[model samples]
Target: MEVGGSPTWSEPNGPPSPDLTSHAELPEKLRPKNIFEIPVWMGEPDRFCGLVVEWNNEPVHVLPFQKGYMIFGRDPAVSNTFVGHPSVSRQHAAIVWSREDRLAYLIDLESENGTYIDDIQIPLNEPVKLLPGHRISFASCFRRYVFIDQYDRVVKELRKSRPTVRVRHILVKHAESGRPSSWRGETITRTRDEARAQIQSYRRQILEKQEDFGRIASEVSDCTSAKRGGDLGPIFPGQNKAAFEEIAFRLNVGEVSEPVETLSGFHIILREG
Candidate 1:
């Protein structure tokens, strides 16, 4: 397997070592993993002028009429009411509540410069639910999108509606013979010296073909694998070329190794173990 960051491949003077295995192999349990958590009102905009609350939440009062009216006011018992404020000239930022239902609400700050959600300008003193994946812009400033979970809570929800395994991989080449191998079920070196050299060489090759790999793989990889742009899978210790296997096993999951060289060419190794 390739080691080091250069294009040249050099075999170390040693035989391969024993294989290694990961401690955990099963997927995580299907539960709320708290993918998104932030303090309440942490992302609120400065000079705020709008308010957003779910129907179940208690009615909120907007004091002094910055740019909108309060819900359940004195005169009219309107469920959703809007009143324009002359002093609130700037368009207030939009607050988004992301949920499984894909519901979003936008409140326009009574401003000369209007508020646009997904490019559609909203009327002053009106509240509109933003469309899915819609962009919310106020006076041209982009406000952060607030994601709400299925329970109607204001926490960033994990998009686990659809889940799939995310795999990363590497291909190894023999340094002396220039033969290409899939690198799955093979032995690798664990020595630091050997791995260092192999990784350097592979890194160089990857840098050279980085653009090509992104483009060519999109067109040439097998249908089953092409969707990932030719990503094969994960490579672990003793699972790939000897030089690469050593370093690949040491990395944490989601860590990508620098390029290394083997007899085959250059390779970029990603740790998904």
Candidate 2:
């Protein structure tokens, strides 16, 4: 970034932080002015463009600026916003555009499996500076990435498919309890708000022990489908409610849905296909 011909970066609200550039010499007239403030438009699409993190032999993720923060993770229920990928932590990492300074920061949310920027594991809760093009990795060593600031280039190169997936779920009923119950023994009556909170909690538990969904569902799910290990079969249109269909269709293969509520009750859905 440049301000008044001077190299620029986000500062900690003090003196202009040291120049991040160590490249070729610049003309005196093009030299940076001290303590320059960045405008709100700095992160706008017309200004800094956006990023595409290429991994798995292709551009797997494209995040546009001015779209608020871009959250990347594996748990669909935990990080209910933005892109979701397999094997990545539910609350993995985020690219935040600082409201205070019009600059971007990548902050890790302290996931079970860590997030990496250029092979260095990001520490929990710390904000790392994001340059124009940097790499980020989630959950594995082979999954390398190249984050580019060019927007149109990535969109043109994007070759992703939106294939549907098969699914199953563990329905932990709250209608009879008047509040959500996870382990099937709570008799205490609670409100809808409490039910929602309990459902979110259950979603977290389900995500962490994903492989045990069927076994756990058979032991815990209130629905009769639990007898068949919670299998819902191929989701056909009109078989389920519109809300459930909307979220079910968006799930990546092998990803699980967060606690979802409907006339039936709170649900923990898994995309088997």
Candidate 3:
């Protein structure tokens, strides 16, 4: 099945499942009451924006708001995004974009603990104008939500239809690596050139000698993923280091990469998706 714009094959030899679509109708009471309260699903030009959950000023999760209402709380049934904190309400808050003002607003749903913007609680059901960089929180929760006005929306739009890749890699860590410990709990002592040579040799084994890539990766790769045959899972855009992502995203499915250097070490990647 096509989930989140990607096809899923349930069986190893079976055809990919059919794409799924949402056909449920929105209830009238949930619809906007006035022209100024227009939802994003109504389809207006230039209305893409989002929120990012941050920790220590760095983004940890992205909450994209591109539809009617971006509801967030502990309840999956009512919330578009789920925040699993004990203090959070069932339906805590929502962010709504207005075409009339070309702006977004945060509305608290009379939550038990209350929704906070910049550490101050907002009035229940009132729309508070949101600005980029404003920190948001749920019921005095530890997680801080930072608002980004544009947030690379243009680049994301350009690549929205681009397919993401799943990859496995063999890493060779050198003495100078950011983390010089191997998956087997051994400290690395090889030089940078030595690591590069080792990675290149592994690539040669897969391409020329037709050696099993996963077996080699499981045996010698320095990454913790080596335990699972170096599987790094599906790589979405902006999910990994720039150097590694660049090489991984460019290779065709089933293709193996040359030695690619990153802060962690040298890697030989095999694209699987």
lDDT of 3: 0.70
Pairs with backbone N, CA or C atoms under 3 Å apart (clashes), candidate 2: 6-32
Which regions of candidate 3 deviate over 4 angstroms? 1-162
| Angstrom error at residue 196, model 3 | 1.0
Higher-scoring candidate on lDDT, 2 or 3: 3
**lDDT tens string, model 2, 1-273?**
221232111111222212423213767656432321232222433335456646566665554554445555443323323233445564567666543223456667766678888778877655565665677777663555455554334333432323345888876555433123444455435555665776676667777775477876687676667788888877643335445667787888888887776644667788887
User: Which lDDT value does model 1 have at 247?
Assistant: 55
TM-score of each: 0.23, 0.35, 0.43
Across 1-273, the per-residue lDDT of candidate 1 in tens digits comes to 011111110112121121111112425463212112221212222123333321223332322212222221101111112122222221243333322122334555354567665567877544465433444444533332222223222112323332223334433334222222223434333343444455465455455655444334344222234456546664322223445555556666766667654433445655554
Candidate 3, residues 1-273: lDDT per residue as tens digits? Answer: 011222222112333222111212546575322212323222222555677777677777676665645666654444545566668775678777544334567888778899998898988766677887899899956778888876356447636865678999999999877457776889889999999988888898899867899999989999888899989998765546567888998999999998888757899999998
Among all windows of ten consecutive residues in candidate 1, which has the lowest summed lDDT? 1-10
Considering TM-score, where higher is better, how would the candidates rank from best to worst? 3, 2, 1
